[model samples]
Target: MRLEGKVALISGGAHGVEGEMMGFGGASARLFVQEGAKVVLGDIAVEDGEKTASQLRDAGYDALFVKLDVTNEQDWENAVRTAVTNFGRLDIMVNNAGTGGPGNVEETTEDIWDGQMDVHAKGVFLGTKHAIPEMRKVGGGSIINISSIYGLVGSVGSTAYHAAKGAIRIFSKSAAVQYASENIRVNSVHPGFITTPLTREGLKNPEREQFMLDRIPMGRIGDPDEIAKGIVYLASDESSYMTGSELVIDGGMTAQ
Candidate 1:
C-alpha cells in the first residue's frame, strides 16, 4: 500500500526480460495498482499492453493502456492526455521505455547508435517534458528514469547503449535540480545485469551467466521485483526528501 491513492504512468509496461508477468514496468504497474494506485500503462506493443491493462482491470484495479511509442512526441502527448483525462491527475512518471543495442566503437553503426539514443535518451526527455506540466498542476510528483550500470561505467560491446544510458543519468540529475522548487522530484535508477526477457539469451549460456555472476559481489542476477521495489520507493512519499540522485541497484557489481 505504499502508493495508496496515487496515480502512476509506466512506459515499457509490456515487455522486457520479465516478459508480460515479470517486466519491470509491468510489475511496477501491478504493484502500484495493488497498493491502491491507478496506473496508466504505455508501450508500443499494443496487444501486450492492452492485455496487461485488461488483466489489471479484471482484477478490480484501476488501469488503462495506451499505444505509445516513446520516441514519438505526439504519442507522448496522447498518452499523457489519456492519463489526466481518466485519472484526473498524474502522481508518478516512470520513463522506463528503453532499448539496448549491440556495438563497440568500431562495430557500431550510425543507424544503431541513433536508434539507441532516440529510444533511451530522447524518449526520457519527451516523457518528462510532457508529464511535468500535469504533475505541476497536481502540486507535485515523482519522475523515475530507468538507467543501467552501463551508464555509470562502460563495458565491452555496449558502446551505443552505454552512451545513451549515461546521457539519461545526467539528464535526470539536471532535471531534478531544475525542478526541485516546483516540488517535482526526479531521479534515475541504475539496474545492473538483471535477468529479463531482453537479456535471457545471454544469461542462458552457463559460461556467460557465470561470467556475469563473477562480476557481481552477490554472485547472482537480480530480479525484476527488486528493481520494482526501488521504483516504488522513489515514486512514493517515502522518498520525498530525495531528488537529483542515482539509486544504484547493481548487486555490488559497481562496488568493484
Candidate 2:
C-alpha cells in the first residue's frame, strides 16, 4: 500500500498498440492499484484503453480510462481534469507515451521526425506543464518521464527517436531543479530491451532474441513488471529525498 491514498494519471496506459502486450504505462497502473491507488489510464487507443480500465475495475480496483492524444494540449487538459474530478487529486503523472521512429537519418522524413518529437518531447513538456498546477494545490507530487536506453547513448536506425528521448532526459532534470523547493520531484526512467508491443515483433526469432541477449549482461530481455517496480519506488514516499535523478533499469547495458 505504498500509494494507499494517492491518485495517478498515466499516458499511453493501454496494454499496447494491439492491447495484448503490456507496456510500461499499463503495467505501472496495475502495480499502483495493487499498492492501493486510484489510477486514471489515458491513451489514444480508445477500445483497448477502455478495456484495460474495465478489467482493472472488474478486478476490484479504482480506475478510469480517457482517450488521450498526448500531442494535443486540449486532450491533456481534459485528462488531468478527469483525474482531479474523479480521483480528487493528482499525486503522480507518468508521461509514458511514445512512437518508435524506425528509420535512419537519410531514410527518415521531416514528418517522421516531427511525429516522434511530438509524443516524446513535446508531449512530456505539456504533461509536466499542466500536471504541476494541480499537484501543487495538494502541496507536492511526482512526475515520471519514460526515456529509453537510446536516450543515454547513440543508436542506429532511430536518430530521431534518440533525439527526442534525449530531450526528455534534460527536460526532466530542468523541471526537477525548478520544482525541488516545492516538493515536486521530477525524474526520468530509462528502460532497455523490454518486451513491449514495439519490440515483440522484432524479437520473434530465436536469433534476434540471442542478438539482444548478447548485448545485455543479464543475458535476457526485461519484463514490464520489473520497470514498473522502479516507477512505484519513484512515485512513493519511499524515495522522499530523491529528485532530478535518472533511474536506469537496463540490466547493465549502459555500464559499458
Candidate 3:
C-alpha cells in the first residue's frame, strides 16, 4: 500500500530482467496497482504490453497499455493524454524504456550511438517535458529515471550505453533541482547487472556470469523486484525529501 491512491505511467514495461512474471516496469506497475494506483503501462512491444495490462485488469486493477516509442514526441503526448483521460491525473512518471547500446567504442557505429542517445537521453527529456505540465496541475508528482551502474563507472564494450545512462543521471538531477519548488521530485535509479532477457545471452556463459558476479560485493546479480522496490519508494511520498539524487541498486558493484 505504499502507493495507495496514486496514478502511475511506466515505460518499457513489456519485458526485461523481471521476466514474463516480472519485468521491471511491469513489476513496478503491478506493485503500484496492488497498492491502489492506476497504472498506464507503455512499451514498443504492443502485444506484451497489452497482455500485461489485460492481466492487471483481470485482477481488478485499473490498467491500460499504450504503444510508446519513447523517441517520438507525439507518442509521449498520446500516452499522457490516454492516462489523463482514463485515470484523471498522473502522479508518477517512470522513464524506464531503454536499450543496451553497442558494446565497444571502437565497434560502435554512428547509428548505434544515435539510437542509444535517442532512446535513453532524449527519451527521458521528452517524457519529463510532457509529464511536468500535467504534474504541475496536480501540484506535485514524482519522476523516476532508470539509469545503470555503468552511468557511474566505465564499462568495457558499452560505450554508448554507458554514456547515455550517465547523461540520464545528471539530467535527472538537474530536472529535480529545477522542479523541486513545484513539488515534483526527480531521481535516477541505477541498477547493476540484473538477470533479464537483455543480459541472458551473457549470463548463459558461466564464465561471463561468474565474471559479473565476482565484481559485485554481494556476489550476485540484482533481482528486478529489488529495483522495482526502489522505484516504488521514489514514486511514493516516502521519498518526499529526496530529489536530484541517484539510487544505486547494484549489489555493491559500484562500491568495488
Candidate 4:
C-alpha cells in the first residue's frame, strides 16, 4: 500500500486501444489501486475507461471513471473536481495520454503537429495546472509526466512527437523546481519502445522490431508494468527527497 489514502487521476487511463490491452496509464492505474490509492480513470474513451474502473471496483479497489479530453481545459477541471469531490484530496497526477509520432519534418502536416502539441504538451500543462491546487489542498503531492526516450535523444522521424515529448520532459523539471518547496514533486518518466497499442503497427513488422531491439543494450523493449513501478516509487514517500528528477526506464537504451 505504497499509495494508501492517496487519490490519483490518470489521463488516457482506459484499459484498451483497438484490440490491444493497456498502455502506461492503465498499467499505472492498476498499480496505484493495488497499492491502496483511490483512483479516477480519466480518458476520452468513455466505454473503456468505465470498463477499467469497473474491473478495479470488482477487484475490491476504490476507483471511478471520468470522461476526460486531455486537450480541453474544462475536461481537466471536471476530472480534478470529480476526484476531489469523491476522494477528498488528490495526491498523484499522471499525465500518461499521448500518441505515437511517425512523421518527419517535411512530411508532417500542420494538423499533425498541432495534435501532438495539444495532446502531449498542452494536455500535460493543463493537467499540472489543475492538479496543483488539489494537491496543495492535501498539503503536497506528486505529478508524473510520461515522456519518451525520443524526447531525450533526437530520432529520425516523428519530429512533432519528439518535440511534444521533449516539451513534457522539460515542463516536468520546471514544475518540479517551482513546486519543490511546496512538497509537490514533479518528475518525468522516459520509456523507450514499450509494448502497447500505440506501437502495435510499428512492431507488426518483424524487421522493424528487430531493428529496434538491436539498438537496446538489454536486447528488448520495456513493459508498462516496469514503468508503473517507477511511478509508484515517485508517488510514494520512499522518494520523499526526490524532485525535478528524470526516471529513465529504457532497458539501457539511453545509457549508450
What RMSD value applies to candidate 4?
1.6
What's the TM for model 3?
0.97
Candidate with better lDDT, 1 vs 3:
1
Winner by lDDT: 2
In model 1, where do residues sit more than 4 Å from their true spots?
Answer: 16-21
Worst 10 residues of 2 by lDDT: 12-21
**Model 2, 49-102: lDDT tens per residue?**
898899999889999999999999999999999999998999999999997898
Query: TM-score of each candidate?
Result: 0.97, 0.96, 0.97, 0.97
Task: List pairs with backbone clashes in candidate 3.
Answer: 17-196, 18-22, 103-157
**What are the per-model C-alpha RMSD values against the true structure?**
1.6, 1.7, 1.5, 1.6
Q: What is the lDDT of residue 225 in candidate 1?
A: 87
TM-score of 2: 0.96
lDDT of 3: 0.89
Shift of residue 105 alpha carbon in model 3, Å: 1.4
- Tens-digit lDDT track of model 4 for 1-256: 8888899999989973324567888888889988989999899889888988888888898889999999999999999999999999999999998987678899999999999999999999999999999888889999999988988998779899999999999999999999988999999989888888678778899998998999899998788788888888988999999988889999999898
